[model samples]
Target: MRPGHGGFITVKNTLLHCYCVCGKIEDAHHLFDEFPQRNDLISWNTLMGDYLHVSQPRVIVDLFKEMCIGGFEASVTTVLYLLSAIGELGSYLGGESVHGYCIKMGFSYNLHVVTALIYVYAKNGEIDLARWIFDGVAVKDVVLWNCLVGKYAKCGMVEEAVALLLGGGLVGELSPGEGESDVVVDPATSSLNLNKSAEESTPPKLSQP
Candidate 1:
């Protein structure tokens, strides 16, 4: 630790996290670019997660592609955050591609990874696949059930959401990495409004007198 610095925080990385959290992505990127070991796996994953912190999902995907070119190995956190970004960005194909990557890398059995998978699939309107993943979980919990509920509600699959709420027997489960477990779903404010078609715009025909 430096003379005025805490044991864990530093000017480059810690400060980079602060900048990213504050939505100053440009500054954070500039600092990350200036760092000598920017390609280091730790540095790369930190920046990727930081991009997620600010909701810049597209850039995070691009960054991961670049990381692949550089031979970087993605940790579970790496894929978790990236899957989240894909869901938010509506990159369904990309999310599916990442799911393949998870299977290839043997991370599919991880509960946190599978939770993110369910969220990503639901957000991408692939509820069948999402429920498939959900079903494979032997030990279900509040986080998993709520993740599905929120996505179903946001996607206007109210029937599915109701079914999940009514049928789910939730217990406690371990929280995933930072920020993943803290999702708050408000259907009115979630921004993915696809329910406009369900309003029954055409009136029923009246019986002829």
Candidate 2:
């Protein structure tokens, strides 16, 4: 049986696991604060992961910053968490700085890190930078290709989107490419198309909801 009152690291890990499983982040923080020993990297990252799972991604960034202030060396997983949070937050400057940090840390060669960077840049309206990253990947997957193509189409870069379709490099599982792939239209894409029509319509000033 585990001790009722263990060392701070052990208690922190137990609380973190409980938080992750039960999804009670507030209680987790309470336990974290009650511990006398400073939280190690695992404690910080575990809590950060819990925040990510809860869709409160922006919290992950603040957690990472606090980890740094506490003198904990961030793991690659911590960097990924921060990047994911930045992507969700649409904080382009923060994302760019994180990207540079990853590069300086020699995590530039890590595929997952690179992909997150590309995705963050693309989602933040830097599609060209996303494309540069995509092209540099020696083994491009279908998901990466689809992300690049869809972003191009979403941004009204129709020609580039078409070129991606025509390149036949990779085929996505959910959304298909140009000719014979049989694509399913999602509501968001359909609504975006409708918005584009509204912008191009006669007089161009349509009623807003």
lDDT values for all models: 0.65, 0.64
For candidate 1, which ten residues in a row score worst on lDDT?
191-200
Candidate 2 lDDT, 41-100, residue by residue in tens: 778767776776677877788888877887787656677667767877888898889888
* Model 1: how far residue 40 lies from native, Å: 2.2
- Total residue pair clashes for candidate 2: 0
Which 10 residues in a row give candidate 2 its minimum summed lDDT? 179-188
Error of 2 at 126 (Å): 0.9
Runs in model 1 with CA error above 4 Å?
1-11, 21-23, 36-38, 170-209
